[model samples]
Target: MDWDKLRIFHAVADAGSLTHAGDVLHLSQSAVSRQIRALEESLETTLFHRHARGLILTEQGELLFDATQAMSKRLDAASARIRDTEEEVFGNLRVTTTIGFGSIWLAPRLRKLYANYPDLSIDLMLEERVLDLPMREADIAIRMKEPSQADLVRKRLMDIRMQLFASPAYIEANGMPRRMKDMTQHRLICQAQGATQVSAGAMLVRELMTYAVERTLTVNNYFGVLQSVVSDLGIGVLPDYLQQDFPQLVRVLPEVESNEVPVFLAFPEELRGSRRVQAFRDFVVEEVVAYRRARQIAAQ
Candidate 1:
């Protein structure tokens, strides 16, 4: 019932040590211990089991900790909403995307975003896992396919296809594979069969495997596959967008490519009015437009 005591309890429960919690809350260890004792007295429950090594949360403590953790996330969400009301765009923006796209594409282009909003702090979480946007796991996400999560503001960013490519050095040494059947002579570098990736990429890799290439290398992510290709190890199945950045990578088997994989950018509908979200969404749209224009010009 007492907010201050509950706050102290949450901190102690989180840190598992009174001294550590005191260090965080700027309170003396004895004072923190006193507050925790008072909270337990008020609630008539033993929240933590004290041991020589450290404190372990009791069942009640675990339940209370869960509630406190939710409260913290809600508080963070409220703070973000409050900050968004300001005219100036600033504060932390958590963006989640696949590692290959985040590291190879979006990360390189983020210089322009930071240049425009110098105060904006971006936490770029790169993984295949789709973070819960509505629950505030991340502020925004750029995913390979449309997000199935409800109450999301989704936009199709662009479409990408998985294509075969090799370094100039590798092609020079092993010669180019002009047809899908010719792949047997070259080593294939690709994402592992059971790895987490878009369906289109997996299909492409499967097709490539049917060629029975003499040697092969499998990585868990496209970034690793790209690294091996660029290192002149072998031909790799990679996204077409990479061609713009790594111009030296020679496209292999021009007629062989995967079906288009739709790229989508999404955020919680509640974040529709968030200035930071809008700024980032607009920036990504602009980048996608510019990328398309660049590709068109190069074709000409």
Candidate 2:
């Protein structure tokens, strides 16, 4: 069976029209029709029933479509693996990560990855939105939360602890909050990005709001929130490691709930066995683990 013809058939069946399928496949309408015809002839079965409105898949076509979709994914994965063997782990790696983590953490570490593998190309995209891996939007993703889907392969990278912090100047001017209840009297900055876990910020805000405490300001990104807190805009919660960089910043409440934010390294399950993907994944995991251990020892 011609894989190309099967691919064309799958596209047409999915699109429900030859014109739309052609548009998707970047082929002419007639070309799409020819490929579908060839596929049907090869299979010796009528795949689609033609109607006045458009094309509809037959019973046999429906079954074939299910099988073809799975086959296409497997074939694509196989092709990527084969290419990896020939190309020496040299391809554009599209990585998705959050703004703060990408800047302060991954960006710096990526230098080492480049140093070890000069041929490897990287396109690092930092955003709050999660990119779809199955759609080929991203080759790898570093997210705060683990993906629950069985089709994705996820590994827990680290446990990020959140702490409520403020600048010394702000605490001096506004008076330090000795208790969570005292937080109500002062202004607090909130993140526009919703927290998936009960981090310090989320916990503080939830408690404050439950008691009808007023929040001063809200920002979209963590970097922006951190900046606001640094400039003494208002007290806000931030990651523990982030405070090490700035001497002026001090933890506001040391007794806040400790939430372990599990960072994950995830990729499509289909690409798990690919040599290049496997190699890069292993390298990143090792680097992150070593970095975490070094940080622990330094803190001690």
Model 2: per-residue Cα lDDT over 46-151, one tens digit each = 9999998899999999999988877776666566766776446776677898887777667777777887778788889989788878755677888888876678
**Model 1, span 62-147: residue lDDT tens:** 99998887787777778888888657999999999999999889999999999999989999999988898878889899999999
lDDT of each: 0.92, 0.78
C-alpha TM-scores of all predictions: 0.92, 0.67
Question: Candidate 2: how many backbone clashes?
Answer: 0
Alpha-carbon error at 83 in model 1, in Å? 1.4
